[model samples]
Target: MESEQALESEAEQGERLGWWHHSHPTFAGITGFFAGMLFVTALPGAFAGLLRLLLDYETAEKLFPFVLLALALPIAMLVKRKTRRFAQFMFVGMVVTALVVLGVASLVLYFMVDA
Candidate 1:
C-alpha cells in the first residue's frame, strides 16, 4: 500500500542500521566474541571467585564493547597493510574462539544442570 518513494526511503533507513549490520565486515566477529564469552561465563561460579563479583548481567553487557575493542586495535595496527586479510583473520579468529568457548560452556552447563 505504500508509495514508491516511501519504499525507497525505508530501504535507505534499513541500510543505515549501524556498525553491526551483516554488510559491515566486523559484524560477525563482534557478535561471535560476545556469544562465546556468554557461554563460557554463564556458569554460576565460573567468574565469581577470580573476578570477585564482576559476573553480573550489567557487567556481561560490556562484552560487546570489549570484543569491538579487541577487533579494532589489531586491525588499526595493520591498517596500512592488506586490510582484507586482516579483516578475514580477525573475523575468523573471533568466530573460532567463540565456537570453542560455546562448546566448553555448553558442556559445563549440561553437566551442572543435569546433575
Candidate 2:
C-alpha cells in the first residue's frame, strides 16, 4: 500500500543504509583492500591450512585454493550488495596485492640468480 514516493524514499534509504555510503571514495577503496585482504586472502589461507591439517597435505595444497575461491564468492556477493562500489574496489585490491607479491617474488628470484 506504499505510494510511489514512499517506494522511492525506501530505495534511497536502502542505498544509504551502510556506513561507507557517505565516506570518500579513497577511504572506500582502502576499506575494500583491507576487507579483501582479510576476507579473501587471509581467510582462505587459514581454511587451506586447516584443510591441509585435516586431509592429505599435498592434495589440500592443490585443491583447497579452488575450494576457497568457490566459497568466497557468496560472501563477496553479500559484501558487494551491502557496500557501495565495493566489488570493484575489492577486485582492484586483490589484483594490486597479487601484482605486488609477484613483483617482489620475481625481484627476489632475480637477486638470488645474480648472487
Whose lDDT is greatest here?
2
Model 2, residue 107: displacement in angstroms? 0.1
How does model 1 score by TM-score? 0.35
What's the CA error at residue 29 for candidate 2, in Å?
2.4
Query: Residues 48-111, candidate 2, lDDT per residue (tens digit)?
Result: 8888888897888777657546545635664656564666666667778778878999999999
Minimum summed lDDT over a 10-residue window in model 1 is located at 43-52
Give the TM-score (vs. native) of candidate 2.
Answer: 0.61
Q: TM-scores, in order shown?
A: 0.35, 0.61
Candidate 1: tens digits of C-alpha lDDT, residues 4-85: 8899888888877754554677665565455444433453234344344557666665543443444455456346554444
C-alpha local distance difference test of each model: 0.57, 0.71
Model 1, runs deviating above 4 Å: 1-67, 74-81
Which stretches of model 2 miss by more than 4 angstroms?
Answer: 1-27, 71-84
Worst 10 residues of 2 by lDDT: 67-76
Tell me the number of clashing residue pairs for each predicted model. Answer: 0, 0
